[model samples]
Every structure is written in structure tokens, then in C-alpha cells.
Target: MKNIISTIAFLFITINLISQENNQMKLGDKIGEFSALDDQGNVWKSTSAKSDFLVVYFYPAAMTGGCTKQACAYRDDKASFDELGVTVIGISGDEVKNLKYFKDSYQLNFPLLSDNEGTISKIFGVPANKGGEITREIDGENFLLVRSITTPRWTFILNKERKVIYKNAEVNAVEDSKNVKEIIKNYSK
Candidate 1:
């Protein structure tokens, strides 16, 4: 009985380690193709991005201060991003409905993906915690937004070859788009 229990524990640990190893991503790593539901409830796939670079940013939640600022910054800089041939995507653990609300509220131009299960966050090695609910007043109506997990602000830039060229774990919400533009400018040169 003791040997069986110990063997089972060993197997569990090994499996967990293997899973983490497979999901872990870092600078220079080529991210595998992935797809998720966007704010419009349409499927967004990595392979569908037609750009010289791709920006994948993970934020904690929707209807929050920092996330809103970050998203708005991106939306405001859509022209610049397009000129630079860069596609921007924001990922969060929020539900699809919540993502739609966020995008609609802010008039976000970029894709906001629903990573409600934290699978994409795990692949990017972004830390996530248990999710909760937040009530926000929108147009005189109180809406409850729930998320499956909360991921810290993190950003990654992938080159045309899909290799991670830049990774920012400590991102400045408001300056994220500006900083990314600078990085892309320099990287292009």
C-alpha cells in the first residue's frame, strides 16, 4: 500500500512538471498556433494575423482601471500600429460577454480575446490567480463581470517568424502602446 501511494505521488509530480515545461514560453521561443474567442464572439487565430509582427498582451480583467487604459491606448494608436504592419491582441481571463462589454464601452479597435480558462496565459508563462466578479455601472445600468482567472499585465512581441523578440512582464498600462511602437521602430531598423 505504501509503495503504491508513493508511486502515484511520483507520477503526479512528473506529469505536472511535464505540463509546465510544455506550456512555458520565453524570449526567442516560437509560440505555437493558437485560437480564442474574440470580443465579437468570432474565432481569432494566430495564423490569421497578416502582419510583420504580433503583439500579444495579457491583462488582469475587463472594466478595470489599468486594463481600460491599456486597451484604450492601443485603440488610439491603431493607425500607427497598422502603418507599422503590427497586429495587436489583448488577452484576458474574462468571459466572452465581459470582453464584448469592455470593447463596446471603450470602442476598442483591436481584438480582445477571452482566455477565461487561462490556457493562453499559461502558455505565455504569465501568472494568474483565482477570478472574481466586479459590478460596474454602464449607462445607468449595473452589470456584473466575472472572470475565470486574473493575469498580471504582461506583453510579448513576436516577429514575422513567430519568434518572441520582446517580453515585458512589468508593463506600464498607459504607456504600453507607445513603448511597443518604439520597440518596433528600433527593431525594424
Candidate 2:
């Protein structure tokens, strides 16, 4: 009985490790190709994002504190990114309308894609919550509303060759663009 239990435990551990390995994207790995809807309702195909490099960031939600900080950081550094010939794309599971509001409110210079089904998050190995709904109060009345899946803070810098040159599973919200800039500068050389 003890031997059988040990075998079962080993199987469980091995399965868990395999699952995580399947989801992770390591350095030098090519990013999986994807096409999704941006905030403006236009299709963005990975093949068509003509640029020297692409900065793909996955954030938890729109209008939230850390997400906003990260978005604004990208926005504030737009000129520098443009100078480097890099294009930034932010992805979240929020509704398209909410993402639009977030962009307009923050004056974000880049496109924010709505990944409502968590497809992009899964492809990028970002942790995402399963879809659900929640009740919220608005002017003293409770209303049921859909909740966007939450994604862990993550960023991937893909070169023109579509290979991931740099990846950060744990991102610092305030210093995100600077970090990306430094990485780009070093990697470009």
C-alpha cells in the first residue's frame, strides 16, 4: 500500500510539472502566432505587425491600479519606443468597450487588445482566471456583470524574427518601459 501511494504521488508531481512546462515560453522560443481584436474592433494579425520588435504585455484588468500604472508607463515612453522602431501592444481579458474607455482615459498611444477568452494569455504562458461574473453596486443598486479574467503581470519582447528575446513573468509596473528599453538597447546590438 505504501509503494502504491508513493507511485501515485510521483505521477501527480510529474503531471503538474509537465502542465507548467507546456504553458511556459522560454528565451529564444518563437512566440506562438495569434490574431485578435484590438480596442477599435479591428483585427490585429501577428503576421501584419510590421516592426523591428513587438512588446506584448499581458495585464490583469483595465482601470485597476497596477494595470493603469503599467499602461501609463508605456504611454509615457511612446516616443522612446517609436525611436527604437518598437511597437507596443497591451492585452487584457477586459471587455472591448472597457478597454476603449481605459485607452481614451489614459490617452494610451498604443492599441489595447481585448482577450476575453484568455486565448492570447494562454499562448503567452500568462496565468489567467477562468471566466466568471460578479455583482457590483452602482449608486446603491447591485447589478450582475461579467468579470474579465485576471492575468498575472507578464511581458514578452519579441524581435522581428518573431522570437522571444526577453521575457518577464513578474513585471514591475512603474519601471516596465525602462526595463524594456534597456533590454532592447542591449539586444539590438
Candidate 3:
């Protein structure tokens, strides 16, 4: 029994290590293929959206202070982003319904994707939210459920070839769009 347990532990450890190593997303690396449900309840494949540049960002949650600020900043600069032919997509672990509400409420023009499973977040190496729970009452019965984890505040700028040209692990919410513009300007030269 002891040997069997030890072998199981070793296998688990090895698998965890391999997953961690595969989750590293760095500059110059093309994003892994992912399909996510967007705010409109449409399945969007990352490869389907091609442009001169693509900005894939992960935020903690929908309708939150920091996340709202970051999203609106991008919305307000739509013209500038459009001028540069950059497509911005924001990802969060929020459900598709919540994402739609947030987008409609904020008048967000870009795509907001649901990452409730944390698969996309893991692939990007962004830390997922640790704890949260929700209690739902349906018709008279009450049920407690753990909330989906959110992703870290990070952004990636990819070039035409879909290779990451710039990555910001710690993004400044309000100033992130401007910073990305600066990087794009420098990068285009």
C-alpha cells in the first residue's frame, strides 16, 4: 500500500510539473489555439480573428472597478485602435450571460469572451482567482456553488503573424491602452 501510494504521488507531481511548464506564455510566442464563447454567445476561435495586430487581454472579473476602467479605456480609444488595425479581445472567467450583461452595460465595442473553465487563462500563464462562492436559490431550494476563478490582469500584443510582440504581466488599468499604443508605434518602426 505504501509503495502504491508513493507511485501515485510521484505521477501526480510529474503531471503537475509538465502542466506548469506548458503554461508559460512569453514574448515572441504565438498564442495556443483556443475557442471561447463570446458575449453574443458565439464561439470564437482565436485563429479566426486575423488583423495587423491583435491584443488579447485577461482581466480579473467583469463589472469590477479595475476591469471596467481597463475595458472602457480600450473602448474610448477605439478609433486609435481601429487606425492601427488592431483587434482587442478581453477574456475573463465570467459566464457568457454575465459577459453579455457587462458588455451591454458598458457599451463595449470589442469582444469579451467567457473563460469559466480557466483553460484559456492557464494557457496564458495568468494566475486564476483563488476563492469565491455563490449561493443560488431556485424556486425555494438553496444551493451553494463555488464561483469560477478569474484570470490575472495581463495583456499580450501580437503581430500579424500571431506571434506575441509585447507582453505586460502587470498592466495599469487606465493607462494600458496608451501603453500598448506606444509599444505598437515603436514596434511598427
Model 2: lDDT of residue 64: 72
- How does each model score on TM-score? 0.89, 0.83, 0.82
TM-score of candidate 2 against the unseen true structure: 0.83
RMSD of each: 3.0, 4.1, 4.5
lDDT of each: 0.93, 0.84, 0.84
Clashing pairs in 1: none
- Residues 1-189 of candidate 3 have per-residue lDDT tens digits of 999999999999899768766777888888768889999999999888777998989988777789889999999998998888899999988778767767887899999998888888787777676635445443466545343886679999989988889888889999999999889878888
Q: Number of the top candidate by lDDT?
A: 1
Q: Output the TM-score of candidate 3.
A: 0.82
Off by over 4 Å in 1: 1-23
Comparing 2 and 3 by TM-score, which wins? 2
What's the candidate order when arranged by decreasing lDDT? 1, 2, 3
**Candidate 1: C-alpha lDDT:** 0.93
Q: In model 3, where do residues sit more than 4 Å from their true spots?
A: 1-22, 131-147
Candidate 1 lDDT, 71-127, residue by residue in tens: 999999999999999999999999999999999999999999999887788778786
